[model samples]
Target: MLVSIDRRCIKLLQELEKETEFVSIKSLSESLDQTRRQTQYDIYKINSLFEFDKLPPIEAKQHKGVRLMDVHREWLKDLLDQENKKEDSEYNYVLTQEERCAVIICENVLRNGFSTLDDLSEQLMVSKNTIFIDMKIVREKLKEYNIECEFISGKGYLINGEELEKRKVFMYYISSIYGLISDGMLDYLQDEDVKRHIEVLHKIEEELEVHYNKGIIEKLALMLHFSETGENTKWNFPQKTGSALVCVNIDHVCRSHVYGIIDKYMKDRSDDEKAYICIHLLAGRMNKEYYLYNETEEIFEELAEKLVGYFETLVGVTMDKRGSLIEDLTQHLSRSSYRYIYGINDGSELETIIRREAEELFNVVRKVADRFSHDIQCPIDDQEVAYLAVHFSSHMHRTSAKKYRYSSMLICDESEKKRENLKKRIEDNIPLIQIHEVLTKAEYTEAEKNKYEVVISTEVLDINDGYVLISKKFDNTDHINILNEVLQSRADEVSSLSDDLFDQIKPYIQKKQVGTVRSIVDHFFGSDQNSTLTQLLTRERVKCLGDKDVSLSWRDAVFQAAYPLLADGSINRHYIDSIILNVELYGAYFYFDNGVYLTHAKDTSGVFRSGVSVMTIPRGINFPHNKKIYILFVLASVDEKEHFGVLKEILKVCDSKEKTEWLLEAQNEDVLYKNLRMIAEKK
Candidate 1:
């Protein structure tokens, strides 16, 4: 009988086998980063498995620690070696719930015959019950692509959907889940056929001066190989009515390379099949420059303008680098729109990170992206929204007055795509440090280390030059470390300059005035703290008008919300009129879905300073279309950037259901202000 053991037990067994003599329990625990008790428990489990297999168990002595006998050590080594080999094979590797679901979908869609529950259970190394549950999840995922997973009693399971839709899901699963076409996936294709397909793709790339991501290359190869192996009959092509750019490019490719190459291998392939290949190529192309000189450039340019215009109106700030922003957005939309329309996921690894780090910008872009979705007649998902957020964030950083104090270099071994992504993340988060160059380990030189103030490497360096080592997955800790380094470098430079300036003027000043001169120098070089939401929306600015004796109209509620700001002279009466006029023209565009009306006008003609006022009415005020507003926030700003911090905080409150509910439940101004302060502090 084989007994099950956790990974810790396996690791402990390996450690014991490696020791030539007895090792102390403390040493063993330290090696594994666990308590002595936990290590003992793991040893017990390992011994149980060894006893079941009739092998020599680990020998532990009270004075020393633990060791494995030669016989048991050899057996354990073999067992571990086998496990390692299994792990190296994708088919034998364990899958997460999501990965299992994706594998099931891929198998059902790509396999020639129906797969039974037993087949899936054995393949995934899970129980039949787990496979059954996974199938249900697989069905729901397939439903998103308008596909269905069907089962017949004795026939097993199969997916039924439009051929193109099924292909889309299959391509997505193969590209995203498996990450590449594995050996198991290529079981049906001959090595020669696979090589031929790759050669054709390479020829196309060379002719077009464009490259696809490795994963995309594999996906296209699989598609081509399958098409040659009699899958072409089921392949259906969608109407080619959109941009002729891809088609024109494909025409050139076919004339130059594809026709000559296909004649020798896949001569029977139809034009429809070739068209399908072109569609995938268009969606998967890595470089944006390919779309720059296309005939559809003007159309994408117009769409980019509308997107930026919509974003500006929503965020209330004129973006810097308007021409560059439009051009970059056009390039992105030209390709990304196809991915959305064809249901191809670009597999952005930064989407979740970007969404979390730039929540305020993501929310604003998500709202603006609705216009793009409408234009393409396809819903833009969070991955695409995250990409848009990066663009806007880079724009925001450029337009800000914050200076980049430290020049930096990034040493990353990732692909060009990933290097650019890391560079963007660093720029977006730590604007004070500008990455001057990205180099691989081979390209990096010791002489270049002294050129940059800050050197960040994804991998550890042999020489210790005080370079900051960060993980490939750049997290908040790495962000803070880089930021601190940049700020410190700036401080050091400023301090040196200030000391020299003060010394030069010291002889001309009196002894009593010396302190004042040093203070002036320090103040001149010191950084100023930007205004925050908590500073603007103080206790005096918050109000809880619960269960009013008389109902108030929307116009009256707007006045009531702005009363605090007006009373404090933060705004004039005309500011109130501007807010009402904005509502009348834009039809409550400021009203959020979380029962909070954040009313603000772009016109700051009647504003004196930046201020925020919050008010909650339990007896909701009547607005147009009988919409009741429970919580209202009025913002008055002298300029765009001054109120931005406060708006971000307000947007965060509006984004959360729990935070909005807590504010709504507050019965008095004190409670509301306390809750608001808590939220701001948490951020």
Candidate 2:
């Protein structure tokens, strides 16, 4: 293991290890008592040692001095300890210029210790000019950590900030310079003490039947190593009171094991120590049952439900098993809160995937995080937001898979008993169709049939759409076979329609728009499909209603605005329900800067097709915060891609106050239609 390395190179290695920022060459020259060429030669020899030893190299900056990247401290310790036997070197290390400045400011300024610019230059073996440049770089980096670097005239330099921020900078630099093993760790742990502590931790793991991850192990070791040192540091425990409440409900056995270990290894343990240990246990354990603490259980549960509710509304999907989803999310956030508070980040690689695949969900999660942060009085970073997005996106994908199988409508005759029996039969025999609603004869409208693919009716219908007539006691395999056959035929028709004139217009329209275009083509050109957006736009599908306020509740308002589309079979009752629930859960998130609320849910289970319906409420309905919404547009799109043009068209009209006001106050449908055309032309 012996190697031929210069003593000065070893000295340089020790200096580089202590430096967080880059050091200048001129400073290194003065520190090492060597010429610039000699200093460069020493650095070269050190790089050779680093390469031979397979250790990370010392990296050099252009203007700033050479600094050690995130190098291995333990390896350097072994080398330095080995080198100690041969030489009595007073200049044991030569810190880079940047590292010297950080040390001078942090140790002297941060601690209120005295050191003038001349004193610092002399102590660090750097010229005053180099010290000035180093301090400038340190000032910029401190901003990222929210620490202020200030220098008062007679007072020299001072780290003026909150106590918590100061310690955060201290801890960060401590880690950066020395890696995980710090002076505190080495000083506290004897060879035997380390072995005894590891044994105790292992015993606790066996008792709890839980294994801690590498992160947890390192964190535990570090905490134990610096427990006494940390106590003396007089650090602020802002999260201590909150963390104690969170730990109140942990599993008794897990808590007991943690207590046993904490008592044995960490003497005179404080509340903060116990809470910190509890967080590590909760985060590192594989069992989800141990996620929640007792007192905060209900609080996290409710928060999880509210979050999922907002997510469902934003993503346009119904979340089943709300209880389970809530529990899981609560557990994660609870654990995450502790880490976020202490600035302990076990970074995620899936953050990019979550951001790219579910960008909208990520944005929604960020908003939720912001709101939640306001409630808890803690900042939620983008990484945490991405983590929540992944959870929501996975749940939505599962819910959508089941929903997409078959969205069906069940219609039976006047006989309640017969209708009930047929519903039961269909449920038992065919698993493909998801019956959205079961309607009686009086409530059933002919228009409703258009919303579904194949409707099972006890009475014979005159409808040309997918209609099936079954007997009263239709609980047979034959009925199932017939219903499935009808479904297959309807699917084939949809496929054919999708293929007809879609290829020509696919490039021009969005993926979600393809289905709407297909429907339009089927209506206009029959089997020979051809259609245009202008022709569709000219149709009275886009309505602008008048100011006579029909007094409606928020839920009722959503339905009323959406009723026109449902009546025409552009959307279904489920889409209407989704919009209402969306408004209920996530209030006015979709509202524009103007006095209009665009009520919409995309790719919800109930969107029969893509369409927009506009309704005006002159006597506006009061939203949650007394924000009056005068105009409401219920936008229903079955998929994500198709709605770009639709949204663009709507936004163009809504963007202008004059256009929007005129459209809302128009005397009649004809006037509104003409105004819409004019606005469309202007766009």
Candidate 3:
């Protein structure tokens, strides 16, 4: 018989097993950090489980405390050993409330029919009341993916949503709960089907000479298996024809291996089903080479370049290694575009923390993502936006000279691959600490003490000084903890420096000027150094080609708008030509969804100074896509940071229909300039 025991009860049994003689209830309560009454209740629960298994109950005397008989002691020892083994297999670890909620969601999503409350209770080893509470959490979580958990009088709990969304929820929660592909996941799928699907994926990897992220592979396998079994027949995926970039014939080896498994479970193969499988296969691929010949590669490349350029313009920093940044963005966009098309939300677990830690950078990247999404005609969610923020943040950190104040050492007993991955994650996210070495438990003990300022260990260490204990699979909480630790260390350094500087300067400064000096210092160190719209778009830079009797050509209008900046030496003639060249090559990407047409170029060689020239043409100039451009803004930037704030204000006006209309109605230079300045200064 199976027994459900809480961690407290298990600890109580372990304490009894360790003792040769009777132990006091008070000592046991202290050991488990619970009250004596709670300890007694735990003992009662353990005794009840033993009774069900027909084992001797613990012998408890009022004064002498509690003791298990010899037979009962052996029985507990064996049971604990089995439980430990089960924990090692990740099959029966005690579930936290969050994990329980995730499990409930997975169960509801994976099951073909409704899951009864009684069955869930039995499987999770909790009462129906606990399952009910878990269902509430499950419902809220499912709502994020637009899935609904519905309950009927006798039908139990079922997940209702679009098939794609349901699959996304299933993949996300299942991957979170299990961490990686494991035989333990067979509880959600048929054992034979899972094995077969995994076999097919392995074959595909071998044939393609590529590897997929393990979690992605598992999710893909499950999706493929489910699709093959006629479980995903409700919705039809659009068939994509003609591979533009197929370095390796996907139809030969890749299709054969995948179709072999699909054919066994499914007799008929439809083009829509094939397209579905191919889309997932491409999305799950980790190797960049696999996506080289992708049909949308050229489009993604152009989009990536524009995205990086736009990000640079927004964040006020030039990305280091521009080519590498473009390549990475292209790869991410390729996979993300597929996900966007299919409504698969593969967002990071650290999205909330990333947003909080890099709020300014996140906002900047969100603007970039918004532009990228507009270009592709897709809605990019915050999670994906957060991921793009990470890329830009990491790039910015790499470009800047970061001084590591503290040294860190990693102690992990995992394989070298996992240890290196953890090391990379730590270094990538937390730039304050430099990791000196990665040592195992034995290696750490043999080495010197106090060698590193921060000691991060996968397991508990016997060090006298403080150390951070993180899981082997480092999670978001661990990332935040380490980040806080490093940030606090940096803060301490800054605080000490501030104190010393204040002490040195206090005697020379007057009290009246102290506030002013302090404010200046704060602004110097803390400000982003972005220039406002009015600061850049002065009266000299504003121009109006008032309702030309003969409407200028789009090219002439671009040159006419840029002439003011060129005349004032804010920009050279080359800058204007570059803007024209961009339009010639990219076909008016500078055009916004609003009537405002923003013209700029990344080629700063022709830019002499940072300034903006706003020109209004009441007689709109026709452009490609039949877009009539009434208001033209020529931006000349010499530095990355100075133009960001003004660009943000301009984008704000572009976002508001009323603001755009206000600018369009202005007839002369003064009216256009005044209305534009009013709109720019509104916020």
lDDT of each: 0.68, 0.57, 0.65
lDDT of 3 by residue, 449-490 (tens): 477767888978987543788887665457657765654554
lDDT of 1 by residue, 102-153 (tens): 6677667745567899988887779999999988788766776567778889
Q: Which residue pairs show backbone clashes in model 2?
A: 23-65, 23-97, 24-65, 249-293, 249-294, 512-642, 513-642
- Segments in model 2 whose C-alpha atoms lie over 4 Å from true places: 1-299, 320-324, 342-349, 398-539, 543-586, 591-610, 614-633, 637-683
Ranking by TM-score: 1, 3, 2
> For residue 515, what is the lDDT in candidate 3?
76
Per-residue alpha-carbon lDDT of candidate 2 for residues 417-460, written as tens digits (9 for 90 to 100): 76666775565434444567788666778778778766776766
Candidate 2 total steric clashes: 7
Q: lDDT score of model 2?
A: 0.57
Best by lDDT: 1
Q: Whose TM-score is greatest here?
A: 1
As for lDDT, the candidate ahead, 1 or 2, is: 1
Between the candidate structures 1 and 2, which one is better when assessed by TM-score? Answer: 1
